[model samples]
Target: MTILIPSYEPDQRLIGLIHKLKEVSGDPILIVDDGSGDDYRGIFDTAKNAGCTVLTHRTNQGKGRALKTGFDYVREHGIKDDIVCADSDGQHLPGDILKITEAIRRHRNHIVLGSRQFTGKVPLRSRIGNSATRMVYAMATGKPVQDTQTGLRGYSSEMLDWLCQVQGDRFEYEMNMLLEAPKAGYDLYEVPIETVYLDDNKSSHFRPLADSAKVYFPFLKFCASSGFAAVLDFALLFLLQWMFGSLFLSVIGARLCSSIFNYTVNRKIVFAGRAQTTARTSIPKYFSLAVAIVLLNYGLLHLFHVNVGIPLFGSKLITEISLFLLSFWVQLKLIFKSA
Candidate 1:
């Protein structure tokens, strides 16, 4: 197995980790210096002297780009060995790295993750951040992943190209890899590992607002599209009901208008279906889903408004919020799914 570590503004700890790794395994270790500057040159030089193949980026790109650079080198040189990607921030243990590497051997096509239980004294942001992302990622993919932000991961040589193609240039890139995996016919396997946060994870370069937004961008975009459609649908429903004095006619007419708008925006933008998915193939499937959602929407609205004694407008709000996740999931897994 080959080990790839991407580093930026690293310190002596990185060199220490490299020396310890030398004791753990004799596998070739590749390090990508993500614009760590001349100040960190001593550390990189020490690492190079320790027999690591060092790759440098002129300026800081991001962790995702740094990882891709390492993977590209492996591919360009025709290295057939499986790769284990670990963090240089001293968070990932050498033993855990070997564990993920072994898991990759057993399941070549699966992306093996070294999952942390987050036991003992853990940093507050690390705990809360992992929990939030774990929940959202589970809902988005319909699968539970223990550590959504772990850097100790393993992949077979065959996955180099696909790994390079997955989106995101920073922290979000890792999340995109998980989101895009199932669509590409790959599954994940997690191996339990020790969770060590040195100095309360101060070495981490994660940006809370920017990177989190990118990680959750897929769902956020869907919400934006849904929010627009919901507003239009709500307005149209009330107007039609006032004019025609019939609930069913108003519901159907409003849905007809909103679904067209929703489908157009969703198909062209949000979800950006697989390359082969064209308007010719997507339209019928999309309408079929929209028709089903309309029926369900009406049922829920009637149940809340008539049976449950809520007012029409209030019922509309409740019903829309209730069906939001299902609608997004259906559109994601069926209509605009990547195949």
Candidate 2:
């Protein structure tokens, strides 16, 4: 396995992380120095002394650039079957590194996230930032991930080349990949891991609001389109129901009409030509997944409204939440899979 660590002016914390990883796994460790100044040469030297492969940038590119450099190195060297990405800030534990590797071995072709539970000594900024991004991920992909901001991720060898092709100069790269993964035939799984927030979680370079916007702005754009489609759907549904006296038919028709528009806009504008597959291959599979979601969604709506006496709107709202996990899995399989 190849362990890739992206570092920028890493201090003793990075050396400690490298040592721990070296002790735990014999996998080749590569440190991609993200344009840290000349002063950080000593740290890079320390990593080299510890048997890590060091790649340095002349100037500081962002984390995304460093990560891309690592991917390029691994691919160019033909190291297959053991790949993991960890931050140099010492937040993600070495034990979790082993677990992430194992998860990759099992999943084989999926993206594995070392998910952190939101508990204990959590920084307020991190809390708010992660919570907001997690919600954005949920809204865009219908998946609920507690740690959208986690830099501790594992990828199989097959994904290395795919990852190198992603185009983001900063933090948004990972966020974009998360959105594109399901659309590109990759599976995503979360491996539960312990999270340590040191120094009240202040040892990292994450700009709370700016980076949060960078990561989530894409999803917000999708949300805008979805919102407009929703308005159109509801208006059309109300008009049809008032004219025809069939609430069930009107509601279903409205949702379908809106969902189609939402999917098209999402595939086109939001995904922005990033997804490599055409609608010719994706549309039928997408429609199949949508059909299943409609059934599950309507069933939940019916159960909530008819059995529990919830209003139609309230029932639909609740059903959307309930179907989140199911929808996310199907979307990951059907939408992200290669044709």
Candidate 3:
């Protein structure tokens, strides 16, 4: 297996990690100098002297681009071994790196993650950021991953092409990998690793606000689309009910119109490039879901208004609120599941 380290304005800690890694494994270590400039040339020279294939970028590119550079090099050179990508921030220990490589060897087709358990004294930013991301990731993909921000990850040779094609350039690229993994047909395996924070992770280049926005942008877009569709649905239902005093007709008219809008926005915007099946196949499934939801929505509205003695508008509002999350979940996990 090959070890790929993407370095940008790195310190001596990276050199130390490289030396340690060399002692542990005889595999080739490729370091991408992501525009570390002339001042850092000596360090790259030292790494080269100590036997590392160093790749250079004239200008600083994001971590994702640096990683793609390394993967591209491996593919161009026809290196067929699995690759283990480890961070140069010294947080990823040589032992843990070896563990990830071993996991890749054992599970050849799986993407192995060197997961860290956040126990003991973790930095406040790290804790909150990871927690928020974990929750959002679970909600969006219906998958539970302990550490979504870990940099020590392993990928088999077959995944190199796909990894190169995944979207994003900064920290968001890593998040995108985890989000798209299930849809891309890759099983995920986590290997426990040491959680080491140097000076409370002060060396990390991640811009919390900017990068977090990019990471959560897709889910946020989905919410916006759904919210807009819900508003349209409610307005139509109320208007149609007022015009023609018929709950069934109102429900059907509102759902038919709203479902068309929802499906278009979801298929074209919210879950773009993540569809598991063709539009022809998924459209029927989505229509079926819309029909079922319309029936359930009407039933709940009738029960709430007649049996529970709630006002018609109040029942409509309650029923819509109750089904909001379920609709999103079903569309995400089933309707738009990656084929």
Measured by TM-score, the strongest candidate is: 1
Off by over 4 Å in 1: 234-254, 275-281, 294-322
- CA shift at 123, candidate 3, in angstroms? 1.6
Over the stretch 236-323, how does candidate 2's per-residue lDDT look in tens digits? 8998899889999898888788878977886777655544567887678777877887788878888999999999999988888656
Off by over 4 Å in 3: 231-256, 276-284, 287-323
lDDT of 1 by residue, 1-339 (tens): 899999999978888889888998999999999999999999999999999999999999999999999999999999998899999998898888889878998998999989999999999988988999998788878899999999999998889999999887889989989988997878999999999999988888998888888888888888999889989999999999999999999999998899889888888888774424777888898888766777989999989999999999999998887678777877777677776
Give the whole-model CA lDDT for all candidates, comma-separated.
0.89, 0.81, 0.90
TM accuracy, model 3: 0.82
Q: Estimate each model's TM-score.
A: 0.87, 0.70, 0.82
If the candidates were sorted by their lDDT against the true structure, best first, what order would they fall in? Answer: 3, 1, 2
For candidate 2, which ten residues in a row score worst on lDDT?
Answer: 330-339
RMSD of 1: 3.4
Clashes per candidate (backbone, < 3 Å):
0, 8, 2
Ranking by TM-score: 1, 3, 2
- What RMSD, rounded to one decimal, does every model reach? 3.4, 6.1, 4.3
Error of 1 at 331 (Å): 0.5
Q: Is candidate 2 or candidate 3 better by TM-score?
A: 3
